[model samples]
Target: MRTFIFLCLLFEEFHVRFLVLTTMSTISLATEYRDVRASEILKQIENGEDVNLTDCRIIGELNLSEIEVETVPNPKYSELLESGFFDGEDLKRYGVNKDLKVVESNIKIRNSIFENDLDFSNALFNKSLFFVEGNFTSTVNFLCTTFGDFASFIGATFGDSSYFLNTTFKSISLYGIDFEEMWVRWDSLENSLVFDGLTYVKLVRNFRNLEQFEEADAAYYQYRKLRQAEKSWILFQKEWPWISFPKCGDIFMWLTCGYGVKPFRAFGFGGLIVLSFSFFYRGWPAISLRSEEKIDRICRLLPERLQRFIPTIDWPNPGISRLEPNKHTQKVSFWDAFYFSMVTFATIGYGDWYPKDKFRKWVMIEGFLGWLTLGLFLVTLTNVTIRP
Candidate 1:
């Protein structure tokens, strides 16, 4: 099934309903600025000059929308979009907004601050572009932006949300970019930013193209989680327990195995299951032992002082099991109970010990759980390891 990627939303920092919102620009503006106007920078770029500046405050909105139209056709293949940038799957929902502004200038504006919203929506840079350590006091939009050469945003901080909605790409680096919240929107009907389900699908495919399978899985996991939430709501609206099977199944898949991204969760849950059954066996006399138990016999082979700590019925004799039929049975150690629980869970009935009375019912349940968890573990292992 083709997931609707438009749901990835503009909440690249914001929109859920009509607009994706950024959380970084919540605080009251307090910084003072005395620097070049953003209009001048646009003029410089338009004049085909490389403008490099450091520690400068950019005043006025750096809106790249009204620039000379030089749009590149939306990338039709995954490989073409991997090296620089592309119209990501997020953009596919809105019927391809391809009126991209071409910025061929080599610009490096590092350690600077933007006093207004930085709207570089659909801007394509043909040269090296660096915005390292820059601070955006307001929303920073990078919707459908494409970098043809080196593009880096290392140590950048967004006071509000810096959006990458429908972000096209070739190659880019974003190390240590700080932001408070990321918001996504699913307003495909009227809003221009149509962040739907294919956004994540495209992203996951991109990661796989680069041979970053782990990242692809992680991205898929996030997308599926978000999709599950949406599905749960839709299911709730349509019907109750009768239609809740899908929702319940989704939750189970996520919790038991992280939708298969986290394989170790199965083993961890299995360990918990074993311990829980062990607690039941330890508190009550569930398992029975014969006169001279094999464990105690093995304990005798150890040093005298160590044998006391080995969960043996007696230090010297296996005859202790023969002495008492009632009171002696209750003196079960945690290890013995644990061993019995493990034996039952693993379906390895050695017959050295066996569950007694109603406790056999619990043994059956534990055995079932063992099968389920172990099966999940194997499935998850293959999911994380095999697929690209």
Candidate 2:
């Protein structure tokens, strides 16, 4: 009996020790978890010291107004808000500065009221910056700010006009800035979105112009196109409830050219067709159809060098050596003429191409148009190709 009692005592003592160790470990883990909160870091900042939030995931809503975070020095925070740190009211008022540097932060300010006048003038970001689904109830200025990495502002709702004048983005993802549903005006300046300081390593992708202003202008144009498409579709739907062909055409054109539509080859082919038709036909005459006067008018529009290429029926020699008139002048429709014109301008001399005696002047006109069109296309292509 004494032996059995001794064994029971030993087991009880071991169980108690295990319970004490487990309790201590739980307490330690809780303490460590609390240490990672933004509240704790804000306290350090409030004490006028620099806090490195590097590789730290903050939890809960961060309210800068409540926490005394001032005079933060060289904070090495990276990949912040990766574990879902919610934003509080007027969040930008707390951390904004004239020369602040934020790198690789996935900050989401979903449904939060941002009333603070966030000023990031001359700020620099060396990594990905995101502002997804946030509501900015006040002005946010990024004047002269430099984004040295990928930047995104998708699904964000701005209360007022956001100023990005003179801001330079190294690489931007702006797929959602269309003004179809959103009513927002962009703040414009004389020299906004300049990309003069960009290096070859930090060039933008897809966009040709490295300048920030040019990119902004492109974005604005895209927005305008989307809005116009939306308006046209709405009018079409209202006017013709039974038929939707026109609306479908508008959508097809918009998808092909306006924004992020697919099958780029189709768009290119359509453009080529339009160009060809315009070239083949002399275009619709405003009034009477005096062929000679029309021909003279068209020739006058041709460039000086091309005017010399005009085939003269008065002489037997094919007036110009390299250039020729359209052979199917009688059979070609407006669209066909347009496509032919594009082909000629592109200098893609297909074998079946020739100019009839009646349309001899048009050959010179087409050649001139082709030269000018090709020159413009080359310039744009060069700008896009040169990354730096």
Model 2 Cα lDDT, one tens digit per residue, 1-388: 9999999999999999999999999987752221255466446534544444322334433443444322222221221223245242222343433334433333333323344454444455554555544445566666555667666655455665555644666655443332112211233212222222121112222123324434443554444454555554334454564545566655544444433322243436456654544533534321112243433454456577853564432222221122224531233223234434655556675534455566657656656655644454455455444535
Q: TM-scores for all candidates?
A: 0.45, 0.32
Could you say which candidate leads in lDDT? 1
Candidate 2: where is the Cα deviation over 4 Å?
Answer: 1-108, 170-307, 311-388
**Poorest 10 consecutive residues of model 1 by lDDT?**
185-194
Which window of 10 residues has the lowest lDDT sum in candidate 2?
197-206
Q: Give me candidate 1's TM-score against the actual structure.
A: 0.45
